[model samples]
Target chain A: MNLLEWLPFIVLIPLISSGIVACLPGRFWPWAFTLLAALASAVIAALVLPEAMGSELSYPFGNWQPPIGIEYRVDAANAFVALLVAGMAALALPWAKASVDQEIPERQGAFYALFLMALAGLLGITLSGDAFNIFVFLEISSLATYAIIAHGRDRRALLAAFRYLIMGTVGATFLLIGIAFLYMMTGTLNLADMAERLPEVSDTRAVRAGLAFIIVGLGLKLALLPLHLWLPNAYTYAPHFVTVFLAGTATKVALYVMLRFIFTVFSPDYSFVVLPLSSVLMVLAVAGMFAGSWVAMFQDNIKRMLAYSSVAQVGYMVLGVSLVSAIGLTAAFLHLFNHALMKTALFMAVGCLAYRAGSLKIQSLQGCGREMPWTMTAFALAGLSIIGVPTTAGFISKWYLILAAVEAQSWWLVGLIVITSMMAVYYIWRVIEAAWMTERPEGATRLKEAPLSLLIPTWVLVALNFYFGIDTRLTVGASSAAAEALLGVPTGGLP
Target chain B: MTDNGILRIIARFLIPFIMLFGLYIQFHGEYSPGGGFQAGIVVAAGWILFALIYGLKAGLEVIPEKAMYWLAAAGALIYALTGVASVLLGGRYLDFYAFEAFFNTPQAAQQFGIITVEFGVGLTVATVVMLIYTFFVRRKSEWDEVMRGSDAE
Candidate 1:
């Protein structure tokens, strides 16, 4: 079989490896095995892209056809998402080795095993063609993440993990109920089939209720504005490596599912016109952007600040979705990828600082920039990307979003996007000033630079941000194709 | 430790039957409602009852914590390896039809495949439950005290 034929292995390899890694002898077995698994997954993901970009690939388990047995589908949207997730896992594995050693000294094997399981879960979420299968994978990742988060050295990590568990469980339950409703209405759990049948019963109360439950359920998972209470603590208290992985990939997966449901499983007219979800989403997006940024500006802890900033960043993507236009959806898709690169690098840089300085407080960052020049430099560059500075990945997404808003002639939204981004600059600048301009406290011993293991991954992401920023062909091309695919337009647009 | 002589005698007599029944459920699972999950729980329940009547010490003696860890890992590996076996036999992962090449008929191979997979699941489920029990009831404070003593030494 060709690479496309083996798409299921992209998820299965990590899962099977996780089980094997858990049983392997020696302390380092988990790390080594996970890294190998991640590398294999990345290679497979890249190999599948040429096929994925051209058309969707669907594989049935044990040769059973869809709507009867489980199926894995890889369209441009999900294929790109799967590639992004697998690639992040590959990059994060090395960083996890050094950071996990310091953050969690014991159970390294279980930690790595769980990490791989989480990666497999994410890949499963993106690739599954069935709604119920998505939930199964969602819970698998959630269970693993809760344990990993609780493994943080801080005492509060346990409490944070507990809170996250409660909130996450509720979200999953809501999503499951919504899926059941859809299944009941349509008599099929397959998303493609649901899309075909949903319109026939669009006016039914059950269908409407299902849509509502799904949106709210995914809202909680994605940490969209008002429902984002569990995010800051979970992100702040989880071990730094876990933070980096989850921040980069977890919400992005949830957002992708939301997009899939909105555009593929349900008609846009029903969502945007009949239900007024567009208006609701637009209001929530604007509020989330303002409120999240406003709160982020005042945070004392650097990690928590970034966590809050994530809420704001999600707002931008949601805003793009609310626009309900081809360019708007493309902007949303591009931002999802761009934001992953930006946040993963930033969080990794923070992890480096936490490794050296022994605290994540902004005050502790003072004057360490000079001591850890390479690390801080990466921080600054990623910070600029967050601010949507020219010649960075963040700008590309924001540029398209602005053009989309203008096309819709929503000048106020244009103003809102620009203004909220200014807030992004202010918050990011706080860390920069602390790192670059402030003096090291009196009589403090000089700290050495972060280890190469951590610094290398951070810089790799930083370089990707700039490289993709300068050459927009890959990200833009894939996102536009995905956007067109979602909008039901023929796949030949330059949006 | 039990004051009731009849209770201990009855408990000793019943433990063997419980295990036998668990095995019966596990092997008969693919053709019936009871499968690996229920059988594993039943087996674990037998062990727990023995601990309750005979003391946790007797329970640990029968199935040590170290052994429990290995059992859990081994069970999961068995399940995973079966999938890999199918792939190696020129079929998709988890495709039992590939086993037809080995057996005289496809039905026998499928039966073999399902039974083995169920056995693997039973092994994992039982051990995991025992592991949790050990952590929750048996080790409570003594494990930490032992660690502390070792550190001091």
Candidate 2:
């Protein structure tokens, strides 16, 4: 069989498995089924990546041709993202079983089902070539995410979920409206076709309105600065595994969508030159970088702190996009990949701590470096990556970002980037200090190391941080190629 | 509600016809505007009316809570499996033309696929509507129980 036929299964495996898992009896079967399905998805995505890197692979639903029927189209850009999301799910599920059993003892079947459905939705958003199709997958993922967040051990989880629901619904609606406007203007739902047709009508007021609506809507989803209110609480209170998965995948996918629209569906000239969006994005990105890191320094809850740090990380990615150059896009995509690695590793280490300490407060982590040496070491390593320390994955992306800023002739932005790295150092150090330096609180129970099931996955991700940092071939090659594809340029070696 | 004999009699007389009309809408949807979603809500409205007239306890006896959850899942599964079936038959996913040999024509196979998936949609939509209704209706007591449990804590 031709390998292209396997494209749909990247989404279908998890979609079908979700139903099967929901129907399955007992706890073990659901978790086992989800893991198998997630692994299968990752393998298929991996197999397809090489082909996708060479050329676009298109799968038309029900044998209908594109520009008519919905299509799953994978190129280097989305294929890389699809792999990141599917790979994260595969790696995190082994850790999930132990955490889920502790926190969500009831309705294990339903939880696993929603998890798979959410996985399917994320993959669908990455692979779909149609604009409307992206919206459908976005809702499918967001609805499942809200429900998953509500299952957290804290009662505040419900409030967080509800707040997310309201914000998410508004975002989705704005996106739909924007798509509607695009549909009205271009008369096509297919993104490529719309791109081809949009130039004729790009001057129209409707098209500009659609672009604005799309930016704001996606801004909310990606938690871009002023629109980022819903992210911290949602990430903080979500079940540990849920936070890990969503943190690594969700906003990154949203950023991917924004990148697709700005670079592919709409020309960069139209977005940046004609529209003045570059400066707007640049200003918001810089502001978010400072505000997010500054607030992160003050949070008592470790999860909340990391959530704010994510806001700052998003600023770095957006900063890359605002540069509107090939190297800058590469930097953005590289960070998108690297940040997923480091952040998920960070959250998983936190999950291990939560498993042992039963709380996420900084005080709860006091002396954890002594009690749970393995888990805390993983945390410190991932923390170094987050701080952009040398020979770690985060450093590679920061180097590219600084290079991109220098190439753009933005000396002040480079200064800002350096300052923010220092800010990251300050916040990540607080946790390391709390975990390693401080004495265990009086009357606190002695903590054992987290079980090997959780520690193994945490270390595997931590290992990847160092591995990818040192090995630039895969991350740099794929990201530069993806950047070239997004810019619609011919092959060029790294700048 | 139980003491309102006239209201109960009217609901009992109207319920079957309401469900029959919903079936008519579902089957006729292939030719007309109404389809599974409208049909599902119509049928659910009948069920809701029955509960209103005869009490929730009696309604639960007719369609238990557990069955609602299973049926909701089963309906969606049926819809997905039909698409899988087309794929297994060596066609693209959800390609109804894969069933052409069995049905003797492409159009008939397409019709068959659409009708089958519509039936699945109808089942799911109907059951989910009832499920949401039950959740809302039961929320007060569930909340009270939660409050009582929290007091003990």
Candidate 3:
């Protein structure tokens, strides 16, 4: 069978498997079944790498033409992300088996069902060429997300899920209104077609209004500055497995949607000139960078601190995108992929801590460095990435972002990226020192390392950080191509 | 406990013709104002009326919680099934023109394909709304705090 033909299968594999998983009895061999399904999907997605990298593809739903039929478009940008998500699924499924068993109860089948559906929704969002289609998948994932988050053992999880629901509904509403406005103006919802129409009406009040509404709507979903109120609680309070998947994928996927809209659907010129999106992004990025760092420093809970740090990292992504340079977008996208690896490793390590010590308390983890050296080693490596160490993934993102800042000739913003990242170093260092240097307390003597179930995925992610740092060609090459496609410019320096 | 007012109002005013009109919009999507997502919302709104006016217990009697979940699953299946059916028919997944040249008509296939997914969306949205309501109202006696001084009217 031709590889191009499996475009719809990428989304279908996850969705159909989710249903099959739902039917598995609570006592059934669910882990084996779910892991097999997820790994198969990852392998299928990987198999398409050559075709996807070569050019963009559009598959019309039910044989309908565009401008009416829903389409799934696979470009280098989305294909790369789809691979990351599916790869993470393949890697993390074994870990999820035991984690879900330990954290949740008899509804294991349904939980796996929702997880696959979420994977489907995320892939659908990345692949969909139609705007409203994105909303449908977004809701699919969000509704399932609420159920999954609420399934956490902690009672506070209910409140966190409820809060997420309220914010998510608001975000969805804003996105709907924005989309309605766009449809009114262009009479189209197909993104590439909309881009063609955008130029003629760039200055129209409605288009600008649509731009403002869409950006704000997406910003809320992406957890930008001041809009990030739901993130920390949702991440920290959710079960360990949920935190790993959600923290690693959700916001990054939102960022992908935002980039798709700003660069692909609207001319970069219109977005930059009319909305001054770059400047607004710059301001929010700076605010998020410092605010997230400052708030994180005082937090005693390890997960909460990491959650806040995600906000700061998101700021760097926005900062990179706002530079409005090809290098900047590339940097942002690379960082997004890199940060996912870094956070997944770190969160998984935290999950191990919780499993052994029954807490991920920084103070309590003082001597874990020696006891759980594998996990601690993973944590230290991830932490070093967070600090932008040379030959690590984070360093690559930073280097590109700094170059983009220079291209924009904005030295002060360069300082902001540097200073905020240093703040990241301080917090990451705090955890390292606590985990390794301090003495192990009496009764904290659960000197056991995590089971193979968890260690495998965490280390996979950690090793990736170093691998991608050294072999920048894949990350940089694909991101640069995506940036060029989005900007509609030949690969070159900023205008 | 009962879905009153606009639910009933809209039920009477619009629901009567919505099936026909939803079909119309679904068909006109290539030429005019609606498609899968909007149609799905419309379909969901109808089921919402059932759950609202009738207590969830009564709602469960008609559309059980487990059943609704399965129906949601079915909607996605239908959407995917259309794609597979296309493939089976010898084109690609979702390649409608492979079915018939009627699709070559200006709006025929776009309209047809859109209606297909619209039904899918309707199924999902309706199930979601009902599921959410179930979550909130499953324990009806908890409403003593709301109605105040009595467990029932």
> Against the true structure, what is each candidate's TM-score?
0.96, 0.98, 0.85
Candidate 1 accuracy as lDDT:
0.89
User: lDDT winner among the candidates?
Assistant: 2
Descending-DockQ candidate ranking: 2, 1, 3
TM-score on 0 to 1 scale for chain A of candidate 2: 0.99
TM-score of chain B of each: 0.88, 0.92, 0.64
What C-alpha lDDT values do all the predictions have?
A: 0.89, 0.92, 0.81
Give the TM-score comparing model 3 with the true structure, all chains together.
0.85
Q: Which ten residues in a row have the lowest lDDT in candidate 2 chain A?
A: A486-495
True contacts kept of each: 0.48, 0.77, 0.52
lDDT of 3 by residue, A389-429 (tens): 99999999989999888888999988988898888888988
DockQ of 3: 0.35
lDDT of 3 at A456: 86
TM-score rank, highest first? 2, 1, 3
Docking class of 3: acceptable
Q: Which model scores highest in DockQ?
A: 2
TM-score of chain B of 3: 0.64
Question: What's the CA error at residue B147 for candidate 2, in Å?
Answer: 6.9
Number of backbone collisions per candidate, in order?
0, 0, 8
Per residue, candidate 2 scores C-alpha lDDT tens digits across A202-294 of: 999999999889989999999999999999999999999999999999999999999899889999999998899999999999999999999
Name the top TM-score candidate.
2
Task: State the TM-score for model 1.
Answer: 0.96
